[model samples]
Target: MDTHEAAGCAEGASRRSVLAAGALGAGALGMGALGIGALGGCAANDAGPAPAAGAAVGGHAPGDAPGRGRVLGPADAIPVGGGQVFVAEQVVVTRPAADTYHAFTAVCTHAGCLVANVSNGTINCACHGSSFDATTGGVVNPPAPAPLREVTVTVTDGQLVLA
Candidate 1:
């Protein structure tokens, strides 16, 4: 073959290799991003302590109060001085004192993990050992940089509903 033709072929091969390398690099970056997102949602540093014995775990019951927003369950399901985690709804309802209730998002501020349970006057996240005050939703421990976000709740006909 002519030298010019050989040189052209060599250049084409070099371009193809460069393009392939770029594609592989892009794929790796995409996979890394996906892995980080999955970890944020799924990683729990430890399951942490099991819910304190007989701690409240609220669930919806039939004929609960029908309202303008989501029904969390009967208000009585939340133990006084403790709370219940509504995992599917991403909420926590606490009855810190009789006849009073508070609510907050279950998502942890540290890494987007869900808060696992409530006990000892604090809401707890298993992912990073962060805790928040059950009554005020204030941060009580770290690795968490912020408190859980408060969610408004109301009791209607003895059922707790999102407000």
Candidate 2:
């Protein structure tokens, strides 16, 4: 090719590279911001006194009570051999046996993302695929490093309340 044509192509390629680098830098910055935000949220969550169970905390599900010591509906809300996630309270309640229930923090100990689902006697965190035992809240998968924090629960008059 002619010199001018080759020079023009080189300039265009350089521009593309510069644009790609700018985009990459912006993406990195965004990811860094996200990491910071996640950590900040974790800190805020840790700073508080667990929101007093029923207080109208941020990210609470609709229809949740708005007072201290949250009332998690009926005791039967958590089916036998299954569990329920109370996102507002950041707690998970599981029933491993008849007339018995276990409660633990839903926050994943690894990265602070709430545990997503529970199945087959395990509370699963979708963020990094960590799993904890539904009955004991013990870590059942890697990357968790610790068991979920146990939350005291009591069933009173057919209603479940955080104790």
Candidate 3:
């Protein structure tokens, strides 16, 4: 109603707008910093070329390098037409036939639980009754949206090693 009161109100509104702008600017700066930090983590490394998105490389994602060349056990431990679950290493190794071996992450695709065992020609997960094909790691039961992730493995000197 009065000029002084109106001026005071206008000043207050201007101050609020300035404060809001400052907060927005700070938020933008923080997001930029976070983006730069993420890109910095993707700098070149000695792990060789990166794999495609969602691709499984030895049970690891791109830029994730671990357990390389680590021996799981004697190749003979994996029986024909069945597999062995290495719980500690989080890998399920299968021998579809005597001279062939395949490896997959024991971690279930639906949930993060580790697979319990391999039986009846399938890799069994006790957590949710999910099972994957022993030879191909394909899903054989529900609750698992995807197949078990394939992990590269090699036979060296009678030992099964992660490649």
Candidate 4:
């Protein structure tokens, strides 16, 4: 009810609005570029990064870059069609194929929300209703509006490893 408190709240709200507007504008531009075949013609990653060389996420190799990822186990530890979630670090490791293991940052790309649920081959963020397909790393539902960051995983001998 005081003038100082009201002013502070107003300032906070304004800052948030500005930030959101900037993000929206950038998204519109990116989408436009993709529509014209200027970009986004490759794999689908809602809010995932463009994969830096040697960047490992939860023991997975990224973008076909030759490097070691995080060690999960002796190769067979992560069974086909199975995955594991690291609560402390907020990352998930899923093996959709016997020789392929995908690790995605448990953090939702949208607003950096932590993904809280993974069911029926989907990762769901509790902060919003953004559901992402664990297998394909694509956005399955909205509210997330972004793609999960892919963590490149490589199996070395038998240990699941990341860079």
Give me the candidate number with maximum TM-score.
Answer: 1
- lDDT tens readout by residue for model 1, 1-163: 5331232211112334334554666676844543322222232223322222122222322112223388878999898988898765667788878899988877666655557788999998765578999988889999878877787889999989988
Tens-digit lDDT string for candidate 4 (28-129): 674453332121111122322222223343344322223334454565766677676654444667777777778777766554434665667887765446
Backbone clash pairs for candidate 2 read: 54-70
lDDT string, candidate 2, 1-163, tens digits: 5331232211112334334554666676844543333222121222322222223335553222233477888998788989888776777889988799998877767655567667899998764578999988899997887888888889999999987
Runs with alpha carbons beyond 4 Å of true place in candidate 3: 1-65
Q: Comparing candidate 1 with candidate 4, which one achieves the higher lDDT?
A: 1
Instruction: Using TM-score, rank the candidates from best to worst.
Output: 1, 2, 3, 4
Query: Which is the better candidate, 2 or 4, if ranked by TM-score?
Result: 2
TM-score of each: 0.65, 0.63, 0.60, 0.51
Tell me which of candidates 2 and 3 scores higher on lDDT.
2
Report lDDT (Cα) of residue 54, candidate 3: 44
| lDDT of candidate 3 over 1-118, digit per residue (tens) | 4331232221112334334554666676844543322211110112222222345534565323258789988999888888887755668898888999888877667544556677
- Pairs of residues at least 3 apart in sequence or in different chains that clash in candidate 3: none
Model 1: ten consecutive residues of lowest lDDT:
4-13
Which wins on TM-score, candidate 1 or candidate 4?
1
Task: Report how far residue 83 has shifted in candidate 4, in Å.
Answer: 1.7
